[model samples]
Target: MWEATLPSSRHYQIFGYPRVQTPPPLNKRRVCLRFACPSDLQSRLTMRRRASLRTLLAACLAVHVGCYVVERGDTRVNNHVLREQNLVLEERAENSVHSLIKVTESTSTTIPAPQCVLPPGMAEEIQGYQEVVDRVIDYVTTGDFKGQVYSHLANLVDTFGPRMTGTGELEAAIDWMVEQSIAENLDNVHTEDVQVPHWVRNNESAWMTLPRLKQLHIMGLGSSVGTPPQGITADVLVVKSFDELKKQGLKAAGKIVVFNPTWESYGVTVQYRSQGASEAAKVGAVAALVVSITPFSIASPHTGQQYYSVENKIPVASVTLEDAAMMERMQARGQNITVKLIMGAKNYPDTISRNTVAEILGTHQPKETVLVSGHLDSWDVTQGAMDDGGGMMMSWAALVVMRKLNIRPRRTVRAVLWTGEEQGLHGGIEYFKRHQHDHEQFQLIMESDSGTFTPQGISFSGTPEATCIMEEVLKLFHRINATQLTNPMTGGPDIAVWEKLGVPTGERHLARGLYYSYLTNLLHILNELFFYVFLALHY
Candidate 1:
């Protein structure tokens, strides 16, 4: 039998056997114990004692476990402090992520204005022309030319309603423009041949039948195909942009994809119109429909060109805001919807068109030219009154005004009305090719195509020195409220060819907000002064 002892207190021990000898301590105040056997009978007694010792050991272990539990309670307090620190760090990280997302969203939509730099001799030139600026304004305000301008615009819109490329109305509009140019008495009036594509939209309509049946006003996008004569009817899958569509993958197959991206400006919003169809088709979608982006919602569907890759092609179209809203509501209800599309839309072989050019020849440097231009073509939806007709008229008026002012610019000013700008820059590209050899002869090219708004200022393309010179020229227009000068010309579609060919370019600044609303009143005064100034300077 084996017996053991352990310390119980400073002067006591937990004994496994009676009279167990105590061992010497290795260090002062330390205690130890030892076991010894005397005879067989005593050894038997020791065995009995050992059994009792087992019971005591079990009791001791229980006591130790109880003390350890108290120690564990203290450790739990330390763990609580660490947990609270982790929670605070997590909250701060979440806030930072939200702030970054907001900043990224805001910057994506804003349009930045170009920088302006002034040139030497600008002050003197502006001072010399102060009276001329006042006279120009008086001539515009007092003149009753507003009626005539309105009449011209009304005639254009009435004669050509929704004239998409390749339509007879589009050709008629071009012819009418040429007649106007010839009537203006400008020199070198003629047209340069160009080829354009024709796309037609047939009968098309959309509706939500399951959640609620309601007719939707929609128009087929340019270059889209007609549904089978019977039309395609299917469930709709809505996506915010192309990325979301990709994530849906095969789930979108055989369904109509609705793209509902919002855009603050036409420049940024236009991407969905141009690429939504192709992207949807790549994922096996049968068709795609995008919400119209225009702020003015008159139930008028705007149509523009949509590109198709050879491998992925699908029918595409646009719906007015009101109609898009109805579709969204129905989709949210988990009800299936169907659309009827009858697009007579088809692509024809490219056909012939032309870019019109007219000029005011210079006396000393007849070969050197200063160019002014605007595109003649427009989308088929609206009257195109503000888009380019106003630009064309304004440029034409400028030439006449220069003559009236008797200000013969050192270089001859040439005016061009471009065609096929809606498709690709076809007219401009062709012009560059034909006139590439004489590019160096061009001193400057100015364009007006943004909109028929009030005069704002001008932007220039040239050496930094030349841009400064142009800015100085703009100071003369300050009295008329067009004083801002932007660096790096916002070249027009018609004049882009010259710019790309390395010819210097500039764009007239026009007010954007109120100009489109009162274009007629502005044009009349502008036309009157233009011819008066042009003749005075040149003749």
Candidate 2:
């Protein structure tokens, strides 16, 4: 007989199965089978069908269980990965927090000293001086004292617009300074003769004619030679620095070398202006050009001194930053750019110059000298108002304060307005050599050559203990925001000569940039306060 298989359960049933009723026999294991009717076969079939359904349900349950187990394992893996990521994040956060704490602690630990710790019985004098400083500041700012000093400064600027070294304007400026010094009741107001070399710029222009032709704004560098009347035109060779030029070798020969290097700071990047020409000339380049080193792009031409080699000298100039950038981009694109240079610059025989010196003799100790000074000359391009005019004013105002307060120092205060400082510090060298014999009498020398920004106390070139004492004395200026006192001073160019000769030197740290925009209005106030405080302390 054929059997039917159930698809759901994989079980078979006989086609003709009989239903049997069990009856007890003589023996316990005895059983009887009866032949089934049609109805009995049908009942057997129903019972078998029910059993198959049960088997199917059990198989499905096993499959569902397997799926659940697999899902649980996957979930565990995800959780483990999440935990690791969290731990890494937490570690980074902790490290950052620790770093911040260290920086904060370091900053807080550096403590600055207090200003003005005076002895007993000086309370009244200190109070009087403080009051005077306040009043003077107010008066000066309000334009209450428009004195001869202001007229003199204005007259000087008008008489000689831009007084470069070895120029006619420079000579006129010197005469004006000498006359003013004498008029101010200063003693020994005379000029120390000096010889200065003259460098003249005639005609200069530069442009790029490569991927695109564009006119460039440029200025012939100071002390550069003029090109032949027709000028020299050649392919441009760009160099990032001097070292790169050496590697290029003869490739840079017979080409106009361009130095496109950038400076991170003023102190470091100034070398290119001083030595770029000489370096380029060494590599057989016909001419050289430098991109402006300034941060701002005003399209203004910046001119500075260029060193020339004895064996090889060539014409050099500075171009606007915009022009340089254009050239750089074009060159990077493999475009061949050409530059035509025409510099009408020349150097003449050395001519006579002067260093103006004036003095206010001390009543107590006339022999002991305190030298105060500033450079008298400036570049020809800008007004040089901040570069040195401000310094000159401050020195003069300080002297006026000393005289008004009638507190004579133990040492004579001599003010020297040095000339030809920009030209290799020639005037300072000469003055030092002239006074080499009497250098022993110099008690202190101070120079304010840095721009007049704002007063920021002073830096002293003396023993640690002496500098500490000076710092303490400067404490009175703390209220005026002149707080910090630096050690191991980089004395000004004028005072450097004196320092080398064993004289103690110092330099006032003026706040740099924009701090002195309103200097004219604030001059009187500062002057009065300086005089009052210094006199009270000294007397």
Q: Where is model 2 poorest over a 10-residue stretch in terms of lDDT?
A: 97-106
Best by lDDT: 2
TM-score of 1: 0.70
Off by over 4 Å in 2: 1-151, 404-407, 513-539
lDDT of 2 by residue, 1-539 (tens): 11121222212111110100121122222212121212212111111112111110001111011101011223222222221111100101211110000001112111122233445645454455554455444444344443434554556666676667888888888888778777767777788998776877766777666556777788888778889888888888887666678887587889988887653333334556778888888778898888775544667556767777656888888887677777777778888989888877888988888988887787777887877777777777644555566566556555654554444565677888777777678778888888879988887777876565556666556544455445555655556666445433443766666655667777775444332222221222222222222332332
Per-residue C-alpha lDDT of model 1 across residues 1-539, encoded as one tens digit per residue: 22222222111111111110122212222222221221111111111122212121111111011101011222222212111111100001211110000001112111212233444655575457657655555554555433344456657767775445687877787788778767867678788888777766656677656555667678778778777776777788877666678888787899988887643334335667888888888888998898775644667666667777746677889877677766777777886777655555677878887887877778778888777777767766656666666666666655654555454555577887777776676777788878889989887777777665466666455665555455556555655556555444543556755655777776664434332223221222232222122221222
Question: Cα lDDT for residue 263, model 2?
Answer: 32
Q: How close is candidate 2 to the true structure, as a TM-score?
A: 0.70
TM-score of each: 0.70, 0.70
